[model samples]
Target: MTAMPPSSPDEPLQPQRFFAVVPAAGVGKRMGADRPKQYLVLRGRTLIEHTLERLCGFTPIERVIVALAAEDPYREGIAILNSSRVLCCEGGAERCHTVHSALNSLAGIAADSDWVLVHDVARPCVRVEDLQRLLDRLQGHPVGGLLGVPVWDTMKRTASDDQVIGTVDRQHLWRAYTPQMFRYGVLRDALSAVLARGELVTDEAAAIEAAGLKPLLVEGAQDNIKVTRPEDLALAEFYMAQQEAGQS
Candidate 1:
């Protein structure tokens, strides 16, 4: 695997100003877990802690802001957070709502021109180099961008009866990944439009696309999968070890 380029803190890159909003409010019912996925232990730290460490380590990111559930038990995570540079805010009932709350915490609040990266707390495997690439690509774009992997495997269109209805044209199909980057004001308006239409967006990219803005997709690492099931934690742990080994 090709390694991500190391970003130097002393030589901080200009042009890209990154402010991430990580949403970790969803109860992982599918995982059949007792706690939220972000709070789950991975490699001696909470998954979120690992994510924040990397995000803050990158020089381009101005700040790391997390949107957590209102009733999240904090004492266990407090000291870990105190050791890092991330700021925390209360999340709302829905994903978009939480993002709105988190963005409100931004002092100046981004003008329509500023950029915001909406990342998934569960997607802890997002690589700094890949993120940097996406940031670089977004600088000149008319709208913004998202990190995604091309569809390499044949896709199936399933029917209600669990039978394959037809084969999908997988040539240009790809799964969207978070750290979905976008212009702050455009995203805000897009999200507002989604709310107005009473539609549920699986990710911020949907909202941006709904606003008639094109978000370019950058090729992302395939290992950067969102953690959902218990087994996924094991895979994420292995990926983490691979990352540390690479850095070493």
Candidate 2:
């Protein structure tokens, strides 16, 4: 991991720019789609288009970097991909690798103190207000946080044999969503270290946690769902409709 220089206490803080990174390399095998799930259409636009629109529309996001597969053919046809504010890079086999690739691509452009908001391409229903809230709440925070929702359901611990081992407590538990925000340099170094150790991290927060950092959890709307299975498409569509109608 690359070491970042310590900041002087008397020095004034530098203005930090915000950037968005979308990892869209997954094939979404669980969705059982012929193409990558991001290429699937929702309403009149592709899922990737809607996701990008939301991120690009956010005023604070200076740039949006999309990590795509090397052999991806669908992105070429998307008109929005031609936007100057949006850039693309070759993705890796897993989500963490894809994110790291996007970060590396921004090496010359984004500063270490800048913030990177890592969002999922499948989650098209992320509310604009919720995104603003996240940025607003995390301002001046040393360790950046992520948008998530508290767990409401009864928790359980199960065994490999599909047997219930015991009941678990759900107090203070959260179902993490994205965009998970973190300092560009911190995230890059943490992810690189974790990957180099041959460990798996489900999200940016996990990688930061392994580096002995605790990220704040900002509660967001429950509708910010990642489209994983076939049924989730319909649910996302419904949520998007509600958002468009100004009801969500």
Candidate 3:
């Protein structure tokens, strides 16, 4: 990866024309894997490698910057992925913080209007069709967007004591997934606001919301599940197989 000259803080931010940011620093405790879920083997390669493989296929994306855990325990994973045009950065304790760290690495090159699609590295089955779906939807809107699937299963709510409370109204519910697309400086400002308010957000869109901007939710697949647990690995493998077979 070539070093990007930092942008001048005082200069007007230019519209971004290239690049994507990926956050891959989680410890993967829920995955029950000794290695980070992103580095875990999938279909013959690590999950992150597969994720980058899909992203690298997109001609619109010029470069990919991965936000990883400091000390980067997955040396083999890194070496395998090094051939791709992807750079690495250290992540923070929290998910959004990791994205912020990746954004900071952009220096002056990232502009408020330039697009940055922040995705979860653990999810290796992200489809090119789904990404195209998002780009098409965002092209018609001012604010950027992300991938989301509507709730299709039965809903349930639990009580504090672990008793069944009632069925949650699933009417307006939608499952949030990556890649959450947005502009660079816009996201930076939104994150800064969240930090100042001492509030936490579950995703980049939430921060964008606090900034009074509404990001478009392009329909995505439920098949794009985050590999957070051991059982999920199998499901992810199946999903990825379908994707590979062009079943998506």
Score each candidate by Cα lDDT. 0.78, 0.91, 0.79
TM-score, candidate number 3:
0.88
Q: Considering summed lDDT, which 10 consecutive residues are worst modelled in model 3?
A: 1-10
Please write out the lDDT profile of model 1 over residues 119-149, one tens digit for every residue: 8888888899898999888775657889999
Query: Can you tell me which runs of candidate 2 are displaced by over 4 Å?
Result: 1-10
Show how many residue pairs clash in every candidate, following the order shown. 0, 0, 2
- Evaluated against the true structure, the overall lDDT of model 2 is 0.91
Candidate 2, residues 18-80, lDDT tens digits: the string is 999999999999999899999999998899999999999999999999999998988878987
Residue 128, model 3, lDDT: 84
Give the candidates in order of lDDT, highest first. Answer: 2, 3, 1
The candidate that wins on TM-score is 2
lDDT of 3 at 200: 84
